[model samples]
Target chain A: MDARSPKRGRRRHGRFDVLWFLGVPILLIVAVEIVPMLGVVWISLTDYNPLEPDSWLSFVGGENYSRMLGDDLFWQSLLNTSYFALLYLPIAIFGAMVAAILLNQQLRGRLVFRGIFFMPVVVSWVVGSTMIMWFLDPSSGLPSMISESLGFGRLPQLLQDESTAMPTVAFVAIWKYFGYNTVIYLAGLQAIDSALDEAAKVDGASALRRFWHITLPGLRPVTAVVVMLNMIQAMRIFDPMMIMTNGGPNNSTTSTVLYVYRMAWDNLQFGYGSAITAVLSVIIFAIAGLQFWFFNRRSVER
Target chain B: MSVEAKHVQTPSRGAAGEGRLGKVVTYGLLSVGALVILGPFLWMVRSVVTPNEVLYSDSGGGIIPRQFTLDHIKDAFTAGVQPFDVYFVNSLIVTVIAVVSNVIFCGLAGFALARIEFVGRRAVTVVIVLMLAIPIESRIIPLYILASRSGLSNSYFGIALPLLVTSMGIFLMRQYVMTIPRELDEAAKVDGCSSWRLYWKIIFPICRPVIAAIAIFTFITAWNDYMWPLVIIQSQDMQTLPVAVGNMAVVKDQLRWGTLLAFSLLSVTPVLVFYLFLQRQFMAGITSGAVKG
Candidate 1:
């Protein structure tokens, strides 16, 4: 392996070899990702508006950040996003765990079952969110029909009701993503050493005990990854909120990203929108950092 | 490798003494799960074929529609600000360019990071990993500004530029490339093959599976992307399917249940068809990419 290292190879080296291979992607990333990332910080400090080109050159200091602190809608949207994550995270993780265990079983049509579960993941969010709206539509949806058939009284308009809109949106988000988490979990479950489970069985351990002791421990790393990724995704939820509820009835389902979108596009408040985005970016980075620290500490301890 | 070997052995262990009752329970549970998972999609399809009269009627909600019609689908194509066909073509153009650029650019970068002894390889890898943790949505404001300022907005290139080389794609390709034995490259070098020749003639050809995986993932993602395209492309004729469908939802009048459902069905059909044909590879690609990350 050392002999095969390009640095030590017999072939003559060129000064620009790295540039040849890395130039295009590096340039693209810098232009698209890196530049914009740095620009967001600057943009957040200014009162820039696309609609009024004159405001683009002016800086308003920390006014945007101060305004965001006092803005009820910004705080409400942040809370709404947190609420969605809090509700969706446990259900998605636990449901995916259960589904992954079932898929991992020696059952007929397991592959078909996996495919069925993952079907929603392939469907675009626009479609999934739209279908969910139709499914929950009080006037002519399945929920109302089912309620009527079961004599369970009239169903509320889930998306249009402030009390129910956030939860309904969260449920749709969970439905769209749990299959993906399940696939990751299934991969994690498959990677666990079967011999450990078999050994526990031979020691007269019950199925529940084996799963609790062996399988659960084996899946900790995957669970951390799944939890962190899902949380980040949930915190940034936009499409479902945009499509199904539009941050209404009365901003109940407004996510942080959706709020940023509205501020910038709908209100033409680019600086204020960038300020919220900066806050969100910080929060997300902190969450990710905390997750990595926790996971790395746990792995080291084991 | 050990895990895979045990996976093959464990199935036999489960089958040897498992009860008929257990099998029944497994099948029953899986059937219910499948029904729940597929129910919404079936309802979407049902709505697409159901006439507006039946769809709006009180007694009309079922997996099977009372009366069928393609009129809603026909209207969905024709009843937008711009025809749905234009949006579909715009989506195709953006997605095609994105997929091709991702494969070429990410493939080149992945190969270099995996095989080349670059001066700043470690730094580049760390930066990519860090970038993965940052959600692209958080950076949208500035990206939108940059695109607008550069006059890339409302064009296919603007829609495709930000997505041309994903950090995940680079990481996925790098991981796959690393698994290709170094001896092969060394042997190529011994045969007097230039570095470019080695990549083009030997390495790239062997990376077909990973390339396919990247292609499918990139294509689906680029096709289904909404927010970026919504911000970038303003003109009705230039809007992608997701953006156009999103606009339809917002407009209220064009968003009748039948028409909206038909629109949803049409928008997702291509990716759904792609997944149906290559699900194994798609699933493998996702799980492998996730595990490596």
Candidate 2:
């Protein structure tokens, strides 16, 4: 199979490789992603709702976008998303930074600590959410029992209560996420020159002074990235809110993504859902653009 | 001059003394922070083993379950809590297929992009980069429709196929492949190795670390995904771990907190075990290899 086989074998192999490697991926991407996205855009321009079969027969331009602006639920979702972002961004960034700094030091058993912290991040959110739900259960949960025992007298069930739902979701989201950010921060911290710390020490700086003046400033780019990424992620919150609250006793935990899902799937308002998604995409684009802008500005100044 | 040198050395010695105090504070803060991060996991283990009666007991100084029993574990295994077995199996199947498919395809695509200079290559690279910003939600509904139309809606292929070829996978693999020296390709070519043979025999082995990283990331992402499966699959028998666990936890009418907790504990063990073992690689994978452009 050596001499005469070379010509046939080479052609066959080349053909097979091209088909198997290049052709299949291109086909899969086109079939699954590109095609669907085009369909979504097409439907977004039409006044289509799965719930109303007749609406599919007609096309309307920008009407759905206009309706979305006046929709109260859309406004509520936007507000809810902003609030979620506000709560999640700072806690995740600062908590991760502090944890990363602590872990980055030559401490004992840092790997074990890192694993324990990051365990939740890799675990399915369903598991984490369910576990946290039990932890917060009013009647049978540990938190309520502790509260009652401590004479706080029956703490409200978090997921069921309007005021507590969104914040509680945020808390859990932070818990599940900070480990990833911490790891990123740890990576960033390692890149910093230790000579800066030594220089600060030689200048008679205190621990806090060194941290604020040198370490924090050194961590600015990472901080910017962490904050921006966290903000975007937090705004896209849905799974926990849906599982824990079902959009709540009163739409308290109705994040924008959740709202979009309900609109597109449950309410069957495809056009409206698409409009909301478009707005969200634009906003996210703007935020990320601003982050890049700030990053460039800082780099230039430095 | 000798007196001045002595004074300079004294301040350096004093700063060294301060460093020890700073070290103590740093370690103390870490210990407390570590406790906060790990506390919930400990509590979860306790809850899983604790009997319902103990869980619901009114008199409680600490919430740790007394007389730890295997009752919760027993019930979760026996009872049909949101079809636990089915969902677990479904998750395993999807994750395995997704990982294998993603790794091979991504590696091939990555190889082509990194080494080959062919027509349409630049366009392909640009498209992959731009699409990274687009989340699954943007294409989800349309994909759902396509899946339904194709009669693949509830099938594992339906859910796993789209995930198999992510832009992130391509991005990661491209970064990894670029780091391999071009000299190896030239050496292989001189040995009468074709381009595909060069990558397969020479390059793939050297890229094991990055490939392992990609595999772990893909596995975890597929295993943990909930929303898509929740939407597409209708059959309870086809439900994945996250979907099933979520359904159990959210059963509003008869919310069995104990059963829910038990199921949740069981479902996450596999993922946690995998993560605990490969965490360093996982961290490296996430942080490294940002696409330039």
Give the winner by DockQ.
1
**lDDT for each residue of candidate 1 in B125-228, tens digit (9 for 90 to 100):** 88887887887887888888888878999889999987899888888889889999998987776677777888889889999998888888888789989999
Candidate 1 chain A has its poorest 10 consecutive residues by lDDT at A6-15
* Maximum-TM-score candidate: 1
Query: What is model 2's interface RMSD?
Result: 5.2
DockQ for each numbered candidate: 0.54, 0.36
| Whole-model lDDT, model 2 | 0.74
Query: What is the per-residue lDDT of model 2 for residues A1-302, given as tens digits with 9 covering 90 to 100?
Result: 33655663334234345554567677777787677766666677776765465665568988888898788888998898888878887888898888887777655677877776676778777777777776666765566776788889777876777777888888778888878888888777777776667667768788677778777887888888877777768767888888888887688678888898998888887777777777777777677779878989999998
Determine which window of 10 residues in candidate 2 chain A has minimal summed lDDT. A8-17
* iRMSD of prediction 1: 2.8
**Regions of candidate 2 where Cα sits further than 4 Å from its true position:** A1-20, A49-57, A203-205, A296-302, B1-28, B60-62, B81-83, B253-255, B287-293
Over A29-99, each residue of candidate 1 has an lDDT whose tens digit, in order, gives 88788888878889888899887777767899999999987999999999999999998999899989887
lDDT of 2 at A21: 56
lDDT of 1: 0.82
lDDT of 2 at A120: 71
